[model samples]
Target: MHIGIVGAGLIGVATARELSRRGHRVILVDPEPLSGATHAAAGMLAPVAEVTYDQDDLYPLMATSARMYPDFLAGIEADAAYRTTETLVIAADAADREFLATLAEFQRRMDMECEVITTRAARALEPNLGTAIAGAVRIPGDHQVDPRRLGSALLAQVLQSGGEVRRTRVKAIEEENGPILRLAEGEDLRVDHVLVANGLNAAELVDLPIRAVHGDVIRMMMPAHRDHLITSTVRAMVQGRPVYLVPRADGSLVLGATSREDDLTGVSAEGVFQLLRDAHRILPSVWECEITELTARARPASGDDVPIIDRVADHISVAAGFSRHGILLAPIGAQLAADVVLGEGGNGPLAQSVRLGRFNHSPLEHSTRK
Candidate 1:
């Protein structure tokens, strides 16, 4: 089957890769390719640290995806040689420290393995930490991947598998027994199946209540902190707000992120300042690192903050609404979507709930993606 894929972010690329692996011809359509949230993301596969109020459905999917990372990265890293290791979540302030304490207790109650260390012990793990820091929690299962490298790796895999990638924006999908997609400049292409994996643009295709939530993050080029197991993902609440500092193997520290619901994608000075201020508060030693770049990207947020991954029709399917968990859910989302497209049944929970037509109650009857 010839499959049409919209958007070339991580999800799109992963979906295309999965389909191609299953011997299906894939045509990926996107303008920027990997330069979306997948580009700006810190690439922390931390479902535990990322847990909020009470979203248990997402955790199962996240854990499944997180478990899949080992094998996924093994193949990608064998080709790309990107680093994947443990991550640390830290708390520097009093209030934030208390929050970490609560998180630690919750982890204990849940029978999860995480370590709560003192300020000195935390500093021992990350020597750059500020002396005024309170303490930290280490989640060994939480890992990191270079998003840029991962994107490049996935794109390489797709191209190597004889998949076609078009650098054009897909405007809409037309149904003709199967599905036909309309690209930029009024170009029309026909395919046996169509999948929408573009983050925010999927909403425009389907009338889902998905909106883009903007987050600004700054990347700094600092001294290489490899060889040391200070390798846990560190996150803390700086000044009554949540902030995270993710360290890379190549001595780069990703300091992020400020959540703004505005639709703007431009990197703002204020956003960079907020990241720097939080980074300084969390780890004062990073103040000397050179500011490499500041980036702002919107994460696709749905009403329930969970992805909808079901088919809209026999030939048309949607796979957006991943929000911040796109990276964590990429593998399962792509695999299940590919299985569905290939006429293989799927028992995945996400495949059942992420339907494009699930939320429509208007007079329009069914959801349309044209």
Candidate 2:
């Protein structure tokens, strides 16, 4: 099958990689390089720490994606020869500790395992964690991939596998005999199947309920023991605010993020300040750290806060609405879409729950609630 993916973000790259591997010709369409959420993401493949209320259906997909990452990263690392890192979720307050305990309980309900530890034990594991921390959990299975590295690797893998990547933005898509992609340069590229994975811009081509949720982040160089600063991901909820510090393989630590739904235009000074403040509270010595980089991007979110991975028209598929789960769910979403493109006509319950048209029926909406 010939598949045309209309985005170069993580979803598009993953889809291209998967489709190309499955003996399909995939043409990747996007003007910007693979540098959206994939570049800015912290790349924590964690489902237990990212859960919310009334999102049971999402857990299965997230769990499936989490289970898929080891093999996915192993394949990518073998192809790209990059280091794969582990991830951990931590708590800085008693309330957050309790919340995480409840969260771990919820995960166990889904037949997942997470190890609990005391604040002192957490600091012992990662000595840089501030003394104010209450407790932590070691989810050794949750891994971290450098999104930039992963995107570049996947782009290389896709191209090497005979997939054609066009550096052109898709203006619109129309279904005529098959799906026709209107490029930004006014060139119409037709293909057997089209997948919309353009993040927030998904609303432009189709009336998707997707919106951009703005997030601002900052990065800094790890000062002392830079190489061993953090062996795993450290996340903390300090003073009721969610802030995480992800230490990369190169001694660069990413501190993030702030969620703003009302404003999607750009980064807010207040948002950066809040993130820094929260980060400092978790690691008081961070104030002495040198600033390296600052990033701000919007993640595509939907009413249900999960991703949509279903067919729109006959050959047109919409794969946006990742909210904040794009990186964690990309592998499975791409493979499932490829299956759909190959004429396999079935979506699992979770995928059906996230389909674009699910909102139209409105029959009790168990998927939305569960």
Candidate 3:
């Protein structure tokens, strides 16, 4: 089967790789591959720390993907530079500590492994932690990965598996004979199946209930003397604003992010200032780090905040609305999309769980495609 993937972010690349490995011809189309939300993402695989009380349904998908990371990276030819570091969910003050404690209780009720520790014990693990922190929750199962590396590795795998890559934006998709991908350069290529894995731009091709949720992220370089300053990912509720610092193998730290729905106005000064200020509160050493890059990208999100993976049309499959969990959920979502493309019948539960038909109205009603 020849498959056409409309996005080159983590989801598209992973889906292409999966399809290519399964003996399908895949052509990934994207104008700026890996430059979207995947590039700005911190790549923290923290299903335990990321669980919200209201979004219990999303935990299974995230946990499944998180568990698949080791095998997923093993199969990829290019190294994605994954790290199985534990995560520390710290609290700045008493109120924040209570909040995390409540969350920890919920996690425990859900049969998740998490340890509530005192500030002293938390500081023992991370000595650089500010004295003002009240408590922390140790989530040993959470991990991190380099999304840029993952994208590169997936691209390499796709190419090695005889898949094609077109460095152009898809103008539209028409289903005359099959799915026709009208390229931005005035070329039309028809394929057996079309997977709309593009992030926020997916709405332009299909009438999916996908919207762009903008996030601002900051990348900083750790000084030579302070290399590997924080071994594990640190997520804290600093004055009720969620901030996290994910350290990379290259001695760089990713600090982010401010979630603002429908705000496409790039990174702002206030966002940067808040991130830096909260990051400094968690680890004071961040004050001396070199400010490297400030970026913003819109994550494709749905009303439920869970991903949508279903066959929206006879020849078109929609895989979008991953929100901030794109990197974490890419493997599973890719497999689901690939299964749908291959006409697999046993994926009924998986398909129904994220099916677009769950919505009241068809996404086609809102599609911008001609």
In angstroms, give how far residue 299 of model 1 lies from its true place: 0.5
Per-model TM-score, in order, reads 0.92, 0.91, 0.97
What tens digits encode model 3's per-residue C-alpha lDDT throughout 1-370? 8899999999999999888878889999998888999999999998999998798669988888888888889866534478888999999888899999999999999988999998899899988889888789999999999888888988888888798889999999887877899999899998999999897888789877878888889998989886578988999999888999999888999999698874555897788899999989989999889989999988889888889988777888888999999999988988888888787747555566788777775866544365
C-alpha lDDT of all candidate models, in order: 0.77, 0.76, 0.87
* lDDT for each residue of candidate 2 in 1-370, tens digit (9 for 90 to 100): 8899888898888888888877889998888866687767877777777776698768878888877876776656432423345455667678888888888887777767677877777777778777777778777666666778878888889988999989988877776687788888888998998887888877677667777888887878877654546767778777578888887767778888688876546668898899888888777867877887888888888878878777666777768888888888987888777766675746568657776665663212221111
Q: How many Å off is the CA of 122 in candidate 1? A: 0.7
**Number of the top lDDT candidate:** 3
Give the candidate order by descending TM-score.
Answer: 3, 1, 2
Q: Give the TM-score (vs. native) of candidate 3.
A: 0.97
By lDDT, the candidates rank as 3, 1, 2
Error of 1 at 182 (Å): 1.3
Answer with 1 or 3, whichever has the higher TM-score: 3
Q: The CA-based lDDT of model 3 is what?
A: 0.87
